[model samples]
Target: MVRGRDVILEALENLNEDEFKRFKHRLGTQPLRKGFSSIPRGTLHSLDRLDLTDKIVCYYLEDYGMELTAEVLRAIGMLEEAVRLQQAAGQV
Candidate 1:
């Protein structure tokens, strides 16, 4: 499953500064999906989520047969909402 931890893990596996920066740019933007935004709100610290999401995407595409589709991004957005739900319920 594509999770935030997975994102952090894969990116660090290679540890290339320039490539990481490039990924950050590509996945950083408004509306979230275009920039590989997984979290629902595009606010401060949400970029952190994007950075993680980017890594997960990279890994998923490699091990599994998948592309960075807008729909897929949107679906992941739902997962972010679930986190908020858990937090709201004081579960996080």
Candidate 2:
């Protein structure tokens, strides 16, 4: 079953860099979706959660199917190695 997080995850996955930047700019102004509220709202170092969110989104821009997991790994700065392992494992 598709959940609200799934929808937001898909949307983030599809957005391009420019589109994501615009989206971030408009995020506070946009009407809140019930789905988005559940995402954690803090920062790591000086980076906003939205920045990590966008990276996760961008990571799936190609044919990558592991968007959610990849992005979470990316958020913590481990996406590259993880993708490499995924590729080595023939999972990507």
Which lDDT value does model 2 have at 23? 41
lDDT (C-alpha) at residue 20 in model 2:
46
Highest TM-score model number: 2
The lDDT values for all models are: 0.37, 0.40
Q: For candidate 1, lDDT tens digit of each residue in 24-76?
A: 44434423323343433333233444455554445334222122322233343
Clashing pairs in 2: none
Error of 1 at 3 (Å): 6.4
Per residue, candidate 2 scores C-alpha lDDT tens digits across 1-92 of: 44323434444445565544444444323333243332232322233344544543453332332334334334444545436434533422
* True lDDT of residue 9, candidate 2: 48
Q: What is the TM-score of each candidate against the true structure?
A: 0.29, 0.35
